[model samples]
Target: MANHPDQPAFPFRRPNPLRPPGEFERLRAHTPMTRVTTRLGDTSWLATRYEDIRSVLSDQRFGPHLHGGAMGWVGEARTGDSLFQDPPGHTRLRRLVSSAFTARRAEEMRPRVREIADSLARAMRDAPRPLDLAAWFGYPLPITVISELLGIPQEDRKQFRAWSDTFLAVSDETLAAAAQAWSDLNAYVVRLIADKRSGTGDDLLHALIAVRDEQEDRLSESELFMMAISLLVGGYATTANAIGIGALHLLHNGQLGALRADPSRVAPAVEEVLRQQAGGGEMRRVAREDVEVGGVAVKAGETVLIPLEAANRDPGQFADPLAFDIGRAPNPHLAFGHGIHFCLGAALARVELQEAFAALADAFPGMRLAVPAEEVGWSVRLLDEGPKGVPVTW
Candidate 1:
């Protein structure tokens, strides 16, 4: 698993939090699919170009295996984690919760989302000056939204959110810590599922549990537990990151003025924000058979890393790619990724972000970062990355 002498490291560092690693642009243009070594010491085909990355993502020749093992499966197959499995398992699991995240469902939730956003915005406005928006507003907004949607008790949300924060901490930091947090999280979900069976709740979890009981052939106990864990974890983390980073981008580039001026632009502005901040993690896939990527021969069992941020900024796909234009049309960025494994919560996330930024625009039209841009720290995370905290004043 040693790196080749000439092969570049898979994840180059980013000095700027808002931008992807500088190497991505050069690599994307000249050598889109170069061989590189991951931090795991595993060699992988690094795909930077949009066309090649999108092609491999859509291709059936690849599966979720990464670095010769299941991706981040610490215990019990990470059961119900659709990210680690291939279809028809991934397909079926995704189908169970897909209805809750559809565009129509998202629209239905808009009034509630607006209510939450306005409440959080008012709290932020009332808070003491120079507060961290990421902690004070960004993270809590989505966590509360998702927790309420899932029927998690208001009191239980704090405890499980703490566990999730710990669980997301690097696995190598303290294996026991992550394991215990995960176990506690799963146990809580199981208990909550049991609680739902006796009650007549109208939340998403109650409905899902009913489906499991009525059609055991479709959903198993473990899958049910895992899906709960997945939805909670997957539901908030990325959108939370997007809110923090997107807010930072608007503050830096002065896009908030345009948003404040025109309400219709907020939705498209969210899309641009999503497109610009796609540097969190690469999509990892293992070739099931010998395949060619970007004219290079990739043998079976080889790992391929697709950096979504690189593809998002590819000048070939976007004009003035680095510039954050609020009105950027035909913005087809792979922030949520492409293909079947695309994020299941995309529609909901969009609703959250759109509502979030809109509220911020109205609450603090003059909001500005309290410190130098470079002084801001990024999260020490396994999968997604974003501003650790955004200190701002209006």
Candidate 2:
């Protein structure tokens, strides 16, 4: 089925594993905001320019709580997904949870998170060559840190990865698996919330449970359930993927040696990674009222999909956008969305990435891709995108 010229359809094939679809540049240059047909045949507006993408997110007129056939089965609860909810409820929930992810809180976690990263690095050092770093190091560090922060029991850590994958399944092809995974995860969280009431601990989950009251400042049972699920999946998945992606890029770009030689560059390097990645999918929303994005008229109830990866790589914003320069300064990329809708866990994510790459580079400065660069498989589970597995050796 051919797509209309005015409405380009996706899945847009990515002929190159590491690069976004080349059409993004063409759209950004000619029509920053144009109508798009999603893979499911739902029509939405696509926003590609850096400035326009930022504007759409920050404007309250472009809201969350998007509903359409494109969101698929997992999005049946999109209204409750903390990432897609609008205020004043979103404002209240964000304010309540902000305490747990404040800069101070993330700083406090650095020592422990670093310890986790170092431990993984040590194990990697001793293991046989050509290990799947994604399995051994990439997924483990963030999963461990998030589990600890959420007060999830040690026994529950393993299943968290599989459960979190539910958010990645945004298409009907995987609807059955997504449904089962979501059901299992939902039941687990409900049980855990019940279990937490009888205990006394200082985890985020405990804090959330204690706030559930009969009065105005309270979270409903469903809100609590959704919040917990969102945190679990959002906390670990992208960071885990980035570890592998960042490592692959660092090696491919020959920046690992520089990073190892100068420890201070790790933080900036992490920012670069996020800028380049911007997650594997577009940020979705619908206009609550009429909105003008880059001079394009977007009517109320119209869906807008912003491919942040494209925005981050916009040459107009970044100098030599494709080059991987660790020292790139004044880099204002929108890998993370802007405005009040900014990511709450941004601080915590930074802590994990900085510590992770520092520890990895320290342990194996010579580490390189085990297979040919082109051989590394990339998977796109709906909106979630990243390397499938990055096998590497020193």
Candidate 3:
């Protein structure tokens, strides 16, 4: 396989994630799918168009288990949570938690999520000037919600955060660190699983253990622990990114004032925010067979990186992709991805984002970026993307 074939160029680097060079757009327009060197040193097919992404995401030819027994790509496969599985494995795990992620279930959690959002906003109100909203609110709100739902002990949150940090710090860029973090997290989960065995609780962990014992299709010990890890880490990281980046987007676009004045707009605004700003750069999938996508033939075992941020802004799909209009109806963006791999926690994430945005709007209608937009930091190393630190003030 050629390492870096001649193709349309994109700003392909790990740093300066909040803003990539203009090359990505040029690449999408000129070459929808082409080989490019990633920060991890792997040359993968970068799919930038909307239809290509949808087709690849929905096609069963792209299997998650590309590397056989080991977790493929970002170690996410072995880390579990059904994100890496296909067919019976993914289907089964999805079924186990399907009930909890329903729209009705999320609707039920709205009040509670709002309460948490309010509490976070209240705390941020008293926060020192030029606050890091990410630390004070973004990272904790959905994390706390997930922890509460999973029945993780309140005191263990810090430990869980540490593990998650280590986990997120891994990528193709830090293969060694990623491997170590994966092992450490799996070991930690093994103990957590053992502790929860004594008696059941109302938490999801207890529910997971029940699956292990009662269900014939239950997960193995390693699978259960890793599944929990995936949920916790994925839950925390993605929501944190959305909250941080989404809030920043509102501030940048001067939407906070209008939304605060009229709270009815927060729901639709959240969808747009998620569509426009909330995402990591790309996700990895291997082409299981020779097939043409975006007019490019991808052979079996070839890799494809779906950059949601680029696609969300594709002109072919969105009329004015860069324009951040809260009332952008008919927004059929792939922010939550497409097909069966769609985010299972999408409902909960919407609830959390709506609550957080509404709370910020209510508590600090004047909230604005403490730093200039050009000065903000970005993390682009993982499956999700967001600012390094979102500084805000009211």
Candidate 4:
């Protein structure tokens, strides 16, 4: 792809594993809101500054819905995911899911999360030689928790993970695979919803189904299917990646010893990890109208890409942004994003991370990377970036 003179190419490469692309820093310093050519060859405004990114996300002028109310989804209109919806629709769907993801509800799951984490840690400790922490612990912990919460059968969880992997894959080469995954997941969710409708259970899916059946205009059948997919996608990939990346940060910076020494720091340490290890491609939004951002005029219909990783590291937002300090106070990072679109599963992710880290710290105090640091592979294919596998042993 040829780069325009005024626009740098989108998806800039990350030269350093610990920081965002050097180009992001350069862009922030010079042109905070410059044009960039997207992978799809569309020109979009790339927002890198902390304030600018927040404005773009918070402003109603920039919406997730594209022109003519059409979304990126393959099939019919009503079946579109809420992530791609705007205004009243987004508001309604968010309301339906928000009740289930309340802070109290998430807090109630902490003990259960700790139990799952402890079980994974024990398994990791007993495994022969080196084990991939991500495969053994990071991935399965969240999958199990979400599975139990959503009432998915234990036998079906692995297939869900595979579908999730494909859906979140970042490459053009994986487009067909992603589509197939979407079809498979959609069909499975439809069947799951039907099963739940037949007999209500204590699971969140059953509760949602009840709401759909009893409440008027609360949730449509299409929305129900998309909601289940959203919950699975939103609740799974990001948490799994965060766990893997957070583990790497702790191991690399000798923070594991600190965490083991004082497990009370696990919570704050998780926050620091969230801040430092926030890695993902830019978020996409289309301008609903002409808007001025960081003194640059964005015309209607123009796509805007907010680089969260860069915004989280802006020096204006955090002192010594590059340093990995767990105790950094007043940290308002955009790892979970900003504004109304802020992650609904933020509380749950925090609980899972806190418990997972605490359990790992307690279980494998002497853990070290089994492979050389440079040899550790990352998942370039996924929208969220993290170690493909963290091979480690005590």
Candidate 5:
């Protein structure tokens, strides 16, 4: 792939905290799939338009695994998890854990989710004014939910949070920390699995253990460990960030008042939040063979980065794409992604977000940001983009 001098650099940061980077819209209008330099100074094709991004993600020809054993961004290597797996391997792995994250299961957990959210909200209400919602409510809600579902002990939840933070660090300076977190998480999972083997529990981890024991040929110990780690990390971080960002959006747009007046609006409000909050990290894929994206020929072994934020805001796909209309109907955002690799925890995340926002609306209808919107810090370490600390007062 030849680098175009006019092409904006890859991994573009949002000029405004709440909106997609300006370069994304410019790229979407001009060159949908253009060559650009990554943060590591490596050239790759960036797919900006909705149709092109969907094509790249849905098509099997563009797999997550890359040549030279690279996966996604530079310095990121392929893990044995399902994220990097393709075809039969991916299918097999997904099948073993799919039952635990099904829509029905997520729905079944709704009451518990509401309970957790309300409890957290009450705790926030009891605390002093100008509290950090991200620390008190946003992170803990999902962390507790996922931990309970996975049967992880409450005492160990903080360690998991720390490990996940380091594991998702994007900068080269934090690469060592990420690696250490990866090692520590794996070791922890191994120990957890060993503990589960000796006794049975009523959690997802125990169910996975049963499958590994009864169907030894189907699931391996290493696969089980990686799957556990994936569920723990992926399950918590994305939802936590979404809750913080979504709350910020509500507080900014006065949507919380509307939600408080009519609580039923929480569902659509959550969907709209998911749509507008789509700007985060990039999804990576490498061409398995020669493929054309947006009329540009992408050769095999070339990297393709799908900008979810750009695709979600494509004018062709969304009307008034940048607006935060809570009642927007027929919203088909690709925040969870598309096709086979679509997020497995999407339903669970939705439940958590819905309950979270609903609880906040009910508990504190007068909640407002304690600081100026611009004063809130955005996380630079993690892949997801959202407020690092949402300071709120009611």
Candidate 6:
């Protein structure tokens, strides 16, 4: 089939592994907002400029709940996904969960996070040759942290992985299986909430229940359950990918020595990693009304897809955007997104990533990829981007 402008040039290509060389520069040289077909057979307006993306994200008109309306499956959800909410509703849900992710609260979790990272690092250090860091360190640390936070029993994590895998998979077979997974997951969360009610604990679920029934302050059972899912899924998967991929990048780019020499550099390195990582897919939006963004007229109901990876690397916004620079000051990257929908767990993600990289660099200063970079396995259609396995050895 001839390549369609709307369809990514390589539909089956893994997101991070097949990132088009100089994609952002090419988009910037062109104009913003091109018509593109999503993997799910929907047409969307692709927004590439940084300013335009930020505006569209903050604007109330292009909502995340487009699926709930008459649009059907525009490949975006109306409910069950907190990212798809609009104002008042979005505000309410955000407020309810804000306490769990505040800077202070995340900071308080730092010691525990570090302990988790270190334990995983030690395990990796003592493991056999050709260790897959993604499975060993990257996946387990965040999974452990989020499971502990959600009060999920360790025994349930295996099922959690199966459900989450089905949830993120975009293939027809997996898509067909997701509804069942969703049902099972919702039931599981409901039971967890009930358990929290009967036996009080310090976890966020208990904290949520404490105030769930106040007048003008409450979360529906569905909302609470879904929000918890969002935290667990978003919290664990995204950071895990970043840690694994960031470690790979540092190893490949010959910067692990620099990071080891000065652990403080891990902070800036995390930001750069966020800037460089290719997110799994574009952020989807629809025109609330007639809007002119990036000199393009977008009519109501037209879908807009903002590629954060592309925008973060737009040369007009970041000098030498393609080159990863840990010292890139005034970075202003949109990796965490922008506006009211800005990431609530960003502070926690950063702390985990910093601790992870610092510990990894210090422990295995001689670490190198066990295979060629191109040999790393990549799954194209996931919600978060990274290698399926990153084999490394010191």
| C-alpha lDDT of residue 48 in model 1 | 85
What Cα-based lDDT does every candidate model obtain? 0.83, 0.81, 0.77, 0.81, 0.83, 0.74
116-231, model 4: which lDDT tens digit per residue? 99999888877897889999999999999988989999999998998878766635666677778878888888888888889858998988888888985888877877788878
Per-residue error (Å), model 3, residue 318: 0.7
lDDT of 1 at 315: 90
lDDT by residue for model 5 (231-312), tens: 8888888898899889889998878989889988999999989887654455679888999889999999998988787888
- Per-residue lDDT, model 6, residue 308, is 78
Worst 10 residues of 3 by lDDT: 65-74
Per-residue lDDT of 365 in model 5: 84
lDDT of 2 by residue, 1-394 (tens): 3356566785477776667788888888898887777766667788888888888778888776444453555556646646457778788888879988999999999999999999999998999988999999999999999999999898888887777666474456666777777778878999999999888899999888888743435687778888898788888888888888898889888788888899989989998888877364556778888888889788898778877888888999999887777888978987667887788888999899999999988888898989876678887764467788899999
The RMSD of every model to the true structure, in order and in angstroms, is 1.9, 2.2, 2.8, 2.6, 2.3, 3.3
Error of 5 at 256 (Å): 0.7
How well does candidate 3 match the true structure in TM-score terms?
A: 0.92
2 versus 5: better lDDT goes to: 5
Estimate the TM-score of every prediction.
Answer: 0.95, 0.94, 0.92, 0.94, 0.94, 0.90
Q: List model 1 lDDT by residue over 1-394, tens digit each.
A: 4578678876788788867888888887788888887766678888888898889888989887633222354563664354458888988888888898999999899989999999989888888999999888898889988998898888887788788877676545565677788778878887888889989888899988998999998888888877888888888888888999899999988788778889999999999999977544656888999999999999998888987888888898999998888899999998887788888888999999999999999888899999877778877455577788899999
N/CA/C clash count, model 2: 0
Window of ten residues with lowest summed lDDT in model 2 = 65-74
lDDT of 6 by residue, 1-394 (tens): 2336645442334434634345445556775666666655556677778788888888877776332222222234426436447778788889877877888988899999999888888988888988889888888888888888878889988788777766665466555577677667777877878878889687777777766645324577556667777887787888888887787788778888899998778889999988877773555777779888888888887878777777787777889776778877888888788888888888888888888888888889899989877777776435566678889988
> In angstroms, how far off is 188's CA in candidate 3?
2.4
**Superposed model 5: Cα runs more than 4 Å off:** 1-7, 66-78, 81-83, 278-280
Ten consecutive residues with minimal summed lDDT in candidate 4?
A: 65-74
